[model samples]
Target: MLRLIAFAALGALVGGVIVIAVGPSTVGYTVAGIALPVFIIATVLTLIARSVGNAVGASPEAVQQAKDARRLGVARIDALRQTGTQINDQPLCELDLTVQPLQGSAFASTMRTIVPLTAIPMFQPGTERDVAILLDGGPEVAFIDEGELSPAERARLRVPGRGSVPFIPVEPHQRIVDGRRRGPLLGVGRAGRPGRIALFTVVAVAAAAIVVVPYHRAVGQSFAAMQDGRLRPDLRRPEALADAQRALEEAIGHDRVASITVAADFIIVEAPRSAGDTKTDRWTYRDGAVTHDGAATTQPESTAEQFSWTDVALDRVWTLMQDGAEQVDRPVGDALAYVVRATDDDVHSPAFGRPAGPPEIMFSVGDDYGTTSFVADADGSGLTAR
Candidate 1:
């Protein structure tokens, strides 16, 4: 049962990964809805089958052992204690007994067995019953005989003349044989063999649905989007920057552009929420339109100056990116355009020899490998690799 639950949990984890990677969709929800009930039903059926098996008969191995056992004699029950353990509604009991073999003297020993509710009354202390031990086995390996005896025969065995022998202790790990029988581990005897196969089939089908359903759904959706020209974006061109800036300005009704990030498939633009507002708004421009990408957040006021989009000279920046790709031997991946205040160690300081200057546009470009970065001026004046 624990193994079955573990298997079901693993299937759920794999299904969760599929949903995360493909994004939530109708097919993903349907697969989860179906797989959950299937797993529960399979677990319940396995438990029921195991219970029925326990009530039926002993395992095949126990039956073979009984065939080879030899009768020892009557055993007088001295004490019986419950172990607080149960299997299939039967309590496990530790019994103290004196085994009087037909040939040898009576010896005291301990045995552990599972007693059914119906048989508890018959196992009380001072009761005498037939017992047996396996051939080449010790007295501690005794088993209760299943056969019934007449009242006269029971009276003859109770005659008080048997000599006493020393007590022999059995190891805790040893198993004591019980007369009751139980069915096989896999099913309820031979009749449940088909049920076991059916349970396995259910589990297999559940696992397949968990894996294949989400996979085909994601593939079909992606293919459909591609055919409709909705999955691909033409944002790699230099003009995409101007178009994104214009769209963001139009949507926000302001020119307070803070930053713009250009990538192969999309462009993100950040600007102030309104004219002279400290809070910032963000938008993603894809498929030639701008959409609100995130919530507005307050930003600290800065002394740095901002540049006009017309003065960006994106063509010069693209040329520098092409040159960078040649030097790095990798294609350009993304670019970020922002204004930065001139510092004492600014790149312009080498040429102008000034401690500070007006804010200038900073262009940062990276290769597809993401291991290298190149910085350039707004007018594409200088290229420095970092």
Candidate 2:
């Protein structure tokens, strides 16, 4: 709940500030267009974190689903659970659902809505039949266990033309991933016309819109100044980072940003606020940081962007990513891995060099199988993983 509140608050603050600072502009083109969308995204993230956090404790419906799939019925095994010091990519009972292109966007008209399922009987890392599902109105294909499909198995589906069809969709088309496919997917009944799937999708979009639309409009307003170039990102300069920190502390009201440190490209604000093993993380950029002695903490007078540079760089990347977006792909239960290259003098490349000296290129990359936080440092580089 706190996480959700944080997200909503962040959106509200950012959006509200943008809206007020820039006044009102186009209703369509503003960040408000994606406010609800962004909040919708934040909500999804929070729910996912909560769900995975609560994976060990099975809900009644989930238990029943297991029972229904069992011999006597999906029997309730005492929610078998185990966690590790690390994260893994292998699904407990990895299931990949390959929806045809159209089935995926629902609104898009290219492919039939295929709801492939290699779904786990349980969400946690446990044991169940590794399956691949095909939802062509009904279960079009089901890969039993976690094995390759035999010729006979493939032939059973009466796949017309092309003769051979992949047992499962690979790469981009494989949509349903990890536990996000939890709860239930939009379903379809017999006739498939009054498609329950479509209905569910409509309801979902509407529900999401109710929240997303408002959030979208509100946010666009928040960043209106920046978008207009009037409120340029202050973080573009190293000194401006301090000013942003001062402003943030003032906003938190009395909350201290005393521990906040400024980096060339980023600001590390050591906000100590938690009683548990973990605490919340807040990321935002402004004009300045507040201090107790009625003055700005670090540099006296600096630029204004603060850490806002990240937003621009990310946006630029997103814009340029349009063309090749079709080529990139991931597994059903896998996630999109985005990396940030190193930039300081001590920073190294993400790849290895033949004969290294003071410089080493290493990637602090992560994927479904946890993280591969390794550096491509050579013998004489004098650099090590931190």
Candidate 3:
């Protein structure tokens, strides 16, 4: 039960540390997607650690040779030399060193080995010091008697061993001392089961997942989506189009619109006037945005000429009716009426019965039994009675 709690706590601590290390963008995904799975993994590892520790304890005589090797006299550091700035592509200082076994005269000559700078203790070189060197084969060298080091510091100075020349110098408590920092320790029997180390390794991998998955989603996928338009279309972009429409309405005024034309990134609205004319207002839109002109404008000084004449001019007539401009006995009827001459071209003229004047274009408010007929040109000119 305690093992399970330790595993859970370790998983939680790892998850929390990862959430903070990766910054705000990862906080949500880390908790939502990573924490539960990590807890499960840690629990399994803790159980395995305990089981393996017990198995090793049952077979103590199996590694009696390793126990004896550790009791060998310490090796002495003779000199230290900096090799280079990197090792196996890792950014760290490497060193060349010379040492000699103190009690065991195994080597006829002084021993030379290459070590990563992290393995050395915090002491000046050229002084005789107790350290450990692997007998089999290893590039690392470590101090043997560095006391009371923190976990991180101990990791750096830990010696390398294969078939067990003692993975690390034995703690006093592991022997015959009743110390406060007691077991459920990892990796060693009676102190900590080897499971603690494995549990931590699992936690590290889980924490990495929390940071990496969210970063790939938020940063990587977004950049990929930007390269292709088929990934999303204008219909999917409601916010952008809505904002552009608002800008258009504010530009032309809401009460003036007769018809609106929409495009992928632009909008055009036609507004009609009581004078039987139409004005065109246009606006452009960018994705994820809606920027309207600050000062709303019903009509600007200059506009497209082709949009206000001929068949398009009918929009203004429609706007006038929709706005109730024809209700109060206004000049809307006369403003739209026109007459045609038989001698002039009549193709463009309205079919207002028999032709009687030059061809003309005009707003058509209403046509009745011809009581008060009026005529004008396309420019609202040439008004006269037949």
Question: Residue 135, candidate 1: how far off, in angstroms?
Answer: 99
**True-structure lDDT of candidate 1:** 0.55
Model 2 CA deviation exceeding 4 Å by range: 1-14, 19-386
| Candidate 3 residue spans exceeding 4 A from truth | 1-164, 169-261, 268-284, 296-386
lDDT of 1 by residue, 226-256 (tens): 6657443235445545555566678878665
The lDDT for every candidate, in the order shown, is: 0.55, 0.32, 0.37
Residue 311, model 2: Cα distance from true site in angstroms: 52
Q: Estimate the TM-score for candidate 2.
A: 0.18
Q: What's model 3's overall lDDT?
A: 0.37
For each of the candidates, the C-alpha root-mean-square deviation to the true structure, in angstroms, is 16.0, 26.9, 20.3
Clash tally for model 1: 5
Q: On a 0 to 100 scale, what is the lDDT of residue 123 in model 3?
A: 31
| Model 3 lowest lDDT segment of ten | 172-181
Best by lDDT: 1
Candidate 3 residue lDDT tens string, 1-386: 44545444555555455344332334645453555565666676655443332111212232233234552223334344443334354323222233333333322112223344565564335443444433322112344454423345334332222233322222221221111123344334434545665675575556556544543322332343456633322311334334444554454444343333433333444454322344433333333222343322544222222222222232222233323334434433323222122232356745333333333433333345333333344333444433
Q: Give TM-scores for every candidate, taking all chains together and pairing residue i with residue i.
A: 0.34, 0.18, 0.23
Off by over 4 Å in 1: 1-233, 294-298, 303-305, 334-370
Q: In model 1, which residue pairs have backbone atoms overlapping below 3 Å?
A: 57-181, 57-182, 57-183, 58-181, 58-182
Clashes (backbone N, CA, C under 3 Å), per candidate, total 5, 51, 8
